[model samples]
Target: MNRSPRFRTSRTLACAAALLCGAQGLSAQSTAPAAPTAGGDAPATAVLPPVQVRGHYDNDIGTSDAASEGAVTQRLIQNRPALRPGEILEFVPGMIVTQHSGNGKANQYFLRGFNLDHGTDFATFVDGMPVNMVTHAHGQGYTDLGFLIPELVRRIDYRKGPYFAREGDFASAGSARLALLDTLPRPLAEITLGQRDYRRGLFAGSTQLGESGVSLLGAVEAQTHNGPWKVPEDQRKFNGWLRATQRDGNSDRALTFMAYDARWTSTDQIPAALVENGTLDRFGSLDPSDGGRSRRISLSGSTRTTLNDGAWQASAYAVSSKLNLFSNFTYFLDDPVNGDQFEQAERRRMFGGELSRVWDVTLGGREHAFTLGLQARHDRLDPVGLYRNRARDRLATTVEAEVKQTQAGVYGEWNARWTPWLRSIAGLRADAARFDVDSSVAGNSGKASDEQLSPKLGLVFGPWQQTEFFVNAGRGFHSNDARGTTARFSPDGTESLDPVPGLAASRGTELGLRTVIVPGLQSSFAVWRLDLDSELVYIGDAGTTEPSGASRRSGVEWNNHWVLDDVGLPGWLLDLDLAASRARFRDAPSGSDRVPGSVDRVASFGIGYAPEGGRWFGHFQVRHFGPRDLVEDGSEQSSATTLAYLRGGWRPTASLTLAIDVFNLFDREASDIDYFYDSRPIQGGPAAEDRHFHPVEPRTLRVTASYRF
Candidate 1:
């Protein structure tokens, strides 16, 4: 949609003004500190402890006017076993993470019935810094979480749907915010060894910097692996992190720096014909030279302070990254001599910031809350290109271009308690973006801009028996690749093409309930629907855009968490989650309702036994991914797959621990991902349409030893 520059500027300024005014008003009403208690006025300069929230839920369900929002604490992260760091996202309930290429590449994400192809519609953030890349060389929203150091993550806050005003682009399906710990409880050193030549080492620790109440923490990790592929993945990675934090009674501030680098050879997906004919194994590859290399460095800071009856928070970050990838999807289809191999490369720098204020006020004996937030981001990518290559040597260039993108957004929300049992939340958000591209092809260089305004509403009723009912509706959007909005010709400049819109809109509605009536059990159920204005997708492989018809999706999700201690089964926990959905092209012709690559069902179950101060702990978990349509006409489909994991640990002393993990516990033979497409084999024959797949890793065992000083 088109928006006037004057209107966009005014709205942003107005939101900023509101936030400042709220902060000022709260500060003016601050009360004097009370006299210190006990011995000698408690050392006049002592720092106050940070505020803490307790329990399995962050919000007081049935009382707070929120739905589908929850937090996963460090306790859960430490007790679970994940084959890859990206699997940590599985804690988001109903969301699934899988891989189609190699360990160093971004994980394929599926949620809310949408394939989400590498984070297209689901937003992700770490410590207030955006993780999704716009107009990327590989994909529009390519997000790689392999750099994350799981041990340093303090909590993960997640919300599904588009009901929160504070969230912007790429959040139509959902969003996740991860926060890291500013300090470690003690110095730690760990070593891990496993089958398949797997090895890893990690070191992390924190200590006081001086007498200024400031603490410093640092971490370093190095790992190598030759996965289950017959060609050997040969993956190597390195990561480092450092942070300094200061805290004083309900207030905290921190500065953090992170660096990561990785390189690996990928096996890619193998053709069904070859596997069935015994020409190649499931874990074999057509081109062993296919692989990728990537690196990222970032610095960020955040602070929060109390203001009378309210609080204010602010954060800023800067990042630089680079990627180079090689692949041969269609072995000999297009170029029989060169074998259709190509390379995608890009170098980028990004900066962003966010500010927000929250306060509570009483009106007519009823309490109300207000929140205002503002965000801004910019990206510069130079010489992003697509090139034809043979064994990593470039033969020809299809497209070479530079892109500069910027976005600004503002939002405000209000929560009111109409009565003891009724509450409502209303909000509005506005966002604007500008895209500029400079291409080697003369006529393809251009500039474009777009903006949007969205409104949100939610109503809640309940607490009669510790159950809450909610109804929510909102408008959300995801931005298109900047290159797509300005391109006038194909990558080779041989044919003319229409420029796609800069932003696509989506609308969603949800009806849900959350309950805690069973003492130690917490459960939630939600039925939701979403409609997209358009499905214009960026073809990363072709360096162009493809227009698809609009689509609609509806789904149901049920999640449960139970602590068995209250039920006479002490030191036990059980968790179960399930999701089912239907997705189709809106108003499509007969026999064309299916939305390709959309999954129809997903489920997960876990059981764990760990007692407080216990010497031994164990956990068992399973994940199931159901069938999916591979094409719009439903001419092809994929089979279901299930995998289990087991973990057992022993704490020999307060400062030492040992653990063992078994992945793919049952040694199941299944595909991690599957696609139906046309591709020629290395033997050089006519193009054949068949299923391509990457098989899941076989059963493997890993052991770890840790010591804390």
Candidate 2:
């Protein structure tokens, strides 16, 4: 069996060439990067293990006996500073998160190229209770996820691609499920104080009562902070959660409850010029006089039933919320006196509920599995309340507006493990949403319903024991329904003119591969391409409308990491994360429709050192935002920027630790939005609107001390 030197050399060269090619392809699609081995010249990264991840860009793999994907845990969800449920998921790549100063906007989520409508296009659920906003004064919903304190979440799973039916309506692109997994070891508590006069306190406790027939876990956290920035001052939020589980036979069912309170003053929208070129030290902030705040609360529960070799699950829950916007508008005002008062006030209220079920089958052999499910959601919204307009010297005038919208649907998914080496999953789901608006505002009230059907498919192949090849493709859909404006009017039958119903019907796809070379190291890469059609867009003068077709966000990323099997540090782990992506939106009807304010390329990467034995560790994260055009023309609107963050933690005892987080380590200035519309020379050339950007939180430090029993 011994080969000649010439034959051995030729074979070795061929294998090397093939691997090089495969890796190149993977790098361009997957965010997976490669790490250098011991004594090698290449770079190395410490990575989170391939447990399973759910987020906006991918679809469901279900929670069954077959296998479970990675879900964001309570500890992880609470690790960062946030006021609402969506903030925990905002940092994910390919997703844009809109956040006001501090953590006040808890019921709203604008993701995956979606405007902040009713929060319906994206699925929302807690434990098993569906969360939706049926009374979308615009597209705002009643899903107040602000209930779960950073400590209450056992784990959160995100399947961001074509959603499933059992999870219910408004889930064209992805579905979100928040659940409690198990009892914690001990009671944990912490207090955090951050830059800009931010302060937060937290408490948590979990225990197993085998003798009492209960597994209980609960947590409470409250945040009250005054922005060091401007306008949006004196903000506060209180979140609490409780979960109790009872085991019966091969099945275990749990009862969970959550509550939240948030209040804050509104922040003004910075004008275009100041946002684009203002120096870091001179940026304008929301005026302190704007007083807009929202109060939200939710009560929910979910149960699970396990069968022989399979499992069946069902959940039901509801939520209610109210928002008060006592703020001024820079535009669209019909009176000069009220405008001179420098502010206007609007109050909104919303309520909603959800129900769903899921089934699992494992008879197709020990290695194969299948899943089925159905779900429904309902919501009610009051965009605005009537107001008697009275100016300092003018007579009283009455005005009123209301926005109502609801969504319901069903879905299913199937996963297969054909061989020890190959696995795949497929899914389909559909939903219907109704939007109605009535008021003296626009005389544009209508009851319009939109239905969506979507599918998902993905496969993973094991080439070797440690390396797996993967590919995924799915259809994504979102329908325009209405906006969540506190004051706006739509005719009862004006449904045909509603742009949101057909605005979100579009599709996207992705492909990737991963490798683990044995024991302590691994790497992967992937390339993605997305094409959008019938994209809903807007022109300031022409109003909001659905463009003919075509918009996109396609790019490649290379991510990699390694955890040495027996590194000297006992519990210590080394890690690195990297990502890069490109996005663009084109108006098929004409270039004029290609409004600016879109980023072209975005990137992020970082490194960390954690000891295996524990005690203390340090980490650094870096992020890059590509250039963007806020004004929507084909011109450059905002320049790209890079940011860095550093973190350090110390564990004094087995159950106690202290940590510090520092952002903008380099002290660089950044903007949340890009720029303002530049119409200074619009008549001379093409019409253009400049973009106004949201200023970023400046360099600041946050410290937290915690104890976990």
Candidate 3:
């Protein structure tokens, strides 16, 4: 149910006040780390002291199944400086997050040599609830992380490739699972101010109920910003969360509610020629009216029961979301009189549930384990549509439709420790989906169904000298838009369109190594390859993704984390990640084999000093994304991008802290993202092919102050 704006405001304020009051007189304490669920075979959770102390990752050496799988603790997360909530994903090695539009929208993502536009091919979850939306108005698997409150995130578990049975759709490239903290060590309030009129406020607290094993947590956040663009972004956002958890003798359960609302004016990409010839400023907009508004509210619950040497977990969630987006990518290409501006809108309601059980047994003096899981989801979209617009007013309807989609999947896996130094994992998964669409055009109304089966395997060798080797192979799939699977007419109803396949398949293989051979150092490396039956590309102008030719991508990644304490420099940590890949169409001619927008190299380095019981802490980091092919023939290429950030803070007391952050420390002029395409920047002018880019913001600073009771 949707609440009135006034109601939302009142509730937000009430929650904020309640959180502050609940935190009074409560002594601060360190939060205990929880064990990972057996469904994923995750390792134990470990961390250093949490009172403003940073810790290096120490969970992947012998307890992990793959070199590319690991967990990031909250301490590391808190130490990092993130300009936007989505940037938190950067903690995943070799992943790059950028933005081409407003900060309130989903950020663009790149990984494994593929430009995963707005989260395609990557599955993301928050507290067991899937973040990727299928049959979305903007694109398939559109994931928006703006609603996330960075301070509430506890841990991020990530794995690369499609070698795990627990991961389902959109897992071909990788997956990231964000876990929210059940409680905070202390009730806290924070405020921040920055350049470009940026301002934010946050309040959060947790308390236990009397004599019962029940606890409650509440948080609220508000933010506003006017970016450095000629046309101010004028963004406003509000978020709220409430959760209650209970611990029984052998079972743990929790229920959570989350709400988010935001609106912003976008500074979309501009034509390169315009900026080069001084026709437009680097931070300028061709259409100032382009913007969007979004709203989402969700309720979810989860339960877990721990048995002797085994576990059972189950979760259910329901979400209601709406989006009204206006964009003008091609200034005047479609209609010279009214311009090419248009709107994509949708109102969606979705619900899903998951069940899994894991059990261990000893047979013939050998240890063996088995896992079984079931998953199902349904989505109902009312009045999902597209329309031509001049400014923000609709001029003509392109297409309007209602859709119902349902999907279900089941998986089973067997793990065996055949020898003291060897193990094997094998799994199989089957999924099916049905889509029904009611369209404004008769030819586009129909029903379609499809299914897929995937098999997976993994082998692990000896952990000789604190090092382990792994080999994995698997198949994964991503679902297409429900409308695309049955449509026979284009959005304009002027041309006949052939329906695309409902599901696209992918196969992946990897050889990996993980080691802690060097004291204070944890390292992992992987060489992997992925082959897609059909490549998916997002079409910005059309607000949808299209299936392209088959393609292949191969890459290698190296990740390292070091705690300087072993080297006699306590409280210092260093990290480095490097990746390089090659991507091409499988059947294309030699000259045209290159995949457009495929990144070839990426790297990041960071050093942080936050000694235990220290009064001062600091962190500095740098990231680089190598140039990429902007066109199929490789004639056009994008420029490499490099950025630096710094953060320094002082703790004046046990309950008070202040920090300052500097972004783009070098003030470098670079593009956040680039596209080579045809556009008409002027009315009645011929469309010309040129590079379009979104420039990065200039060097900016932010100051934050926080207090705990």
Question: Tens digits of per-residue lDDT for model 2 on 598-617?
Answer: 44555555445554445776
List the global CA lDDT of all models: 0.80, 0.47, 0.82
TM-score of each: 0.93, 0.75, 0.93
Please give the lDDT score at residue 472 for candidate 2.
63
Clashing pairs in 3: none
Cα lDDT of model 3 by residue, 1-709, tens digit: 1112222222332333343231111101101011122123111122223334334464555556677878787788888899999999999999999999998788999999989988889999887778998888887889899989988887787878888887888999999888777777678899999999999999999888998977888999999999899999999999999977777887777778999999999999999999999989999999999999999999877776677867777777789999998988889877889998889899999977676677777789877778777677789999788888999999988778899987777788878878867888888987777778898877888887777788998887878998889999999988888888777777667777777676789999999998889888889999999999987543435734365799999999999988888888888999999999999999899999998888999999999989888888989999999998998899999999999999999999988889999999999999999999888998887899999999999999999998888
For 1-709, candidate 1 gives per-residue lDDT tens digits of 3334434543564555444332211111111111000000000111211111123334345423345667676677778789999998998888899999989989999999999988989998887778888998888888899889887777777878888787788999988887777777678899999999999999998889778888888999999999889889999999999987887787767778999999999989889889999999888899988999999999887777777756677777789999999988889988988888889999999977777776777779877777777877789999788889999999998888899988888788777778777777888988888888998766878888888888998887876798888899999999999888888898777889888888899999999898988967788889999999888888878888898878999999998888788888777888899999999999798588898888899999998877777888888999998988988899898888899999999888888889999999999998888899999987467899999888899999999898888
Candidates ranked by TM-score:
1, 3, 2
- Candidate 2's error at 452, in angstroms? 2.4
Runs off by more than 4 Å, candidate 3: 1-55, 537-540, 543-545
Query: What's the CA RMSD for each of the models?
Result: 5.5, 13.8, 7.7
Q: What does the lDDT come to for candidate 1? A: 0.80
By TM-score, how accurate is candidate 1?
0.93
Which window of ten consecutive residues has the lowest lDDT sum in model 3?
24-33
